[model samples]
Target: MLPLAGERKNAKGIIFEKAYSRNISRGTSTLKRGFAHMLKNGVVMDVTTVEQAQIAEDAGAVSVMVLDKLPSDVRKAGGVARTASIRIIQEIMDSVTIPVMAKCRIGHVYEARVLQETDVDMIDESEVLTPADEHHHIWKWDFTTPVVNGARSLAEALRRIEEGAAMIRTKGEPGTGNVAEAVTHIKKVNDELRAIKAIYDSGDNQDLIRMAREFKVSYDIVEQTARLGRLPVVNFAAGGIATPADAAYLMSLGCDGIFVGSGIFNANDAKERARAIVLATTFWNEPEKVKEAQKMIDERQSMLGLDVNTLELRMQERGGSA
Candidate 1:
């Protein structure tokens, strides 16, 4: 459950204080980001139905994201994609003990508002759905529910954070079943972080300012990220991850967690695949354990991967700009 408004301590020992005690708003950055912190090193799986949500929970998913259609199905449908039904979100929330998340089209503030009112544990201003606005994204701080946004680079991630996004996920090409783009994104973020870290270590404020200007984000965030050597929020890997090896590879790349969409349900062995992914993600550092997880599902049962280079719709580009 989300922490209620007040100076209360959560189960993980994160203290949530009212940012504005006199105002009705309840979501402080501490509360929002702390919710994401609790999900680190776990898998967040996408499910369109209550049964699938149960399957994910049984398979050890830390949370379930409710969607109207899987990312692959949304790609094939080729029309305006929107938020999941309130009934379905409510049903899934009732069915699962773990946190429940739902997506709203990028920049759809009202959709986010509705999800918050529905008492969802988290809201994803996702690129998987057709974007509702092109020039802007929702100012997430206005809402009491935490928001997670996707980013392809450090600059984009910082922009989202500046707009009050509590968590960030790599904007890998969704529904493609190809992990290449996801790998590329995380690596790029890592490389950029290293660059900024080196600049900060050299104590070159001028160069840091230049880098911030180039990245098009605030200098404070850039410097803070440089000082910390990582994203301020939990950074998860999403999009085209189909195999246990794929999950483990992303984990090795320093992702805090994984978000599986269209990978498990699109395959022939959802239950087994889901469990395998969870196992691989949890024991990513142990090679033999990962190998055992790899053997749990047959390779032939995997989803047919799409070449991201040839995709007609590049979902990752949605809501990319500040």
Candidate 2:
């Protein structure tokens, strides 16, 4: 538990335990509030520019994920921060009333705290790109604000959820400009969860959580939802989301929402792509309406191009058994 370096200290003569207890007891359930809003319409937009964010909002995205710059720093230099300036996030928030999310480099709760001050709706502790905080993952439960983490597999997703992430996504392999990887990963996790529900009743939520903790699950989150209790927020697919059709496919497999990062920006038709995703989520499961989303992206999102191969391998190594 590496405490933030500058956390304000108690007064010199303050009665330590009593004062701390009173304030902490009154602590706000910010995470729950955040989760509710992010899941309101079961769709979220991940965008690299303010213009893209406006497009997403206009198309009815439940939330807008803002970034500073994209693709260039990511493809050539591993990954970099999407929100180049706080002003970019502010501008997007100003442009729309829906929830707005900003990413914080992993293990940097202090930065997350700063974003919280900005009054943004949520903070995604996503490894969309390589993190600035080196190897340390952010401790989700420790923050006063709700923080989301990405998982490549069910176990990993549960691990973060156990650590108190308000929401989780399929780990986005940045700069891939695709969605196939996310599609397959999400499908497998959803299937695994449904199977668990088949084997054990939903009444045993506590039992599933215990198993998750004992086994140290680390990847997919849908596994936990089927095992544990229904989550307060929708489980969504993130990463490699290249088109609206891909978004619809994920929703069909039981995802409540979808997160688009590079997928929306790289299409050469950012506005149309964003609209495709919003509409796909809007009528995702209706067969007749679904066909209209077919060409959101004709190409598949390939995992082979990702820099986070080790992260991918970590989940593949211990593939779950249904």
Candidate 3:
């Protein structure tokens, strides 16, 4: 095995090893997917500064996503959004012991390449940033670092996975601080998964093939997902997740993990909210524990949420068709 760096234990006592077999190679499908699996049932928070990254780490976040601006600030700023500064990404990586992730614009291969060269633990080909390519996303297989992409349906998720995305997240309307869209998305993916599972179970190969065509993914991958009854990769709930209840509710809906963007630092009680969301995500199955976590933050201190229907920019739709 080839040992890497940044080995650490999660709040659940899960030891994440930065090691992989040399024969399999560093960015092979198994190693990339395994990197995401290590973060299952944990929270990944977005932060623009080393201070916020440190807070996320101290709050038991599995990893911190470095961004040039918080999603809310991005929406308000309203210019072309790009990747965070390499210096800032490296600074945050140096500040924390946990793995660090940074975002690159969709379809911007060079941006992804730069992030990979920065040695970030992961790269998010995120819609939250202004997409550089309108009809094509970055071909993720070309990079040595694992990449994560967002999806609102099974088809999008499957297509990204087919393109070598190591992880998938729901493209909830980012910066809204509203969990409604995220809920709708995961439910839609679940509904589609159930439909495919039934088709696969009925011994209908023709129907499975047709479904694969409809999803725009390979038959083998569609069949694999149907047999498993879940995503082929770790699926996390993200965008506008503001409260402990929001985190717990999404977990109950069967997400492998949670991603908080702009929800923490935008709120009045960032430190408490960050820790509370992590606690709620970790103990989502237990109502009493979740309630304890919810009490840790005051609602009045939460980020001011925007109505999804009234938003001018629907970030979720950015790279859906691409």
Candidate 4:
């Protein structure tokens, strides 16, 4: 069973220690993968307050992402978007039973440590926040808590996984309420994976070796990914998903799940929209069901979306050379 919030200890008496102290082995990696596995085919909503967390829980969200501001607000109020206050995170934890994930800026290991200490189910090395270090992302292999990082291409995704990110999400132009960028990103990853699989089927190890070198990841990771024809870790679509159709569209495009940031609370019907997004994500294959979900809220009430081109600060561009 997955560990519960604040349950810090297992029967083995393992105390959550500094992430760097944990031994690097297959067992540890599997632990992170397993946690992400549980959240497959679900929607993770971004929330700011305990009330919002409760609403998300009631709306049937599989998990809630705790942050100080919604992505849209983050874009409006330009500054460092750090982790949410621990006190608020704890209160939200108390308000809901589902897994709670908190964001830490890229390369901010100390912030990640604080989140791990708070016993959040997971940490997001989010590009949506202002990056603390542009040259490097946190060495996630050092942490016990699993991390979900963003990527725009297969190479970026593979590199993050090699660095011990248990899950990956497309770093779509966040806070913009535009799904175009997210669609482009997921398509980019899928196309690259297909290309790699073709090379693998041709019995070309040299190409795989070259790709491994180019991605700065081990050959084993490249080989495994080619063999699987997809990311070894769970993959989710995130950024500016504003509607149920957007959620289902991503699911149809081979994403394991969707992450909604400004879509929910900023809308006029937070409760109805949240519930509809969950339903749409879970029943993505059925067009009728998705239509029903789409009708749950009025488009006029949707958050005023910003054009990706007009944005001065593009959060998705933060991570690396993707």
Q: Candidate 3's error at 123, in angstroms? A: 0.4
For candidate 2, the C-alpha RMSD (Å) to the true structure equals: 7.8
- Highest lDDT model number: 1
Which residue runs does candidate 4 get wrong by more than 4 Å? Answer: 1-27
Residue-by-residue lDDT tens digits, candidate 4, 109-138: 999999988999999999888898888988
**TM-score of candidate 2 on Cα atoms, chains taken together:** 0.72
**Prediction RMSDs, each to the true structure:** 4.8, 7.8, 6.2, 5.4
> How many residue pairs clash (N, CA or C atoms closer than 3 angstroms) in each of the candidate models, in the order given?
0, 20, 0, 1
By the lDDT metric, which is better: model 1 or model 2?
Answer: 1
lDDT head-to-head 2 vs 4, winner = 4
lDDT by residue (97-141, candidate 3, tens digit) is 999999999999999989988999999999999999989988777
User: Candidate 1: worst 10 consecutive residues by lDDT?
Assistant: 4-13
lDDT of 2 by residue, 67-119 (tens): 66553235555434434468778888788877888887666666777787897
The predicted structure with the larger lDDT, 3 or 4, is 3
lDDT of 1 by residue, 152-263 (tens): 9988988888777889999899999999999999999999999999999999999999998988877887888898888888899998999999999999999999999999
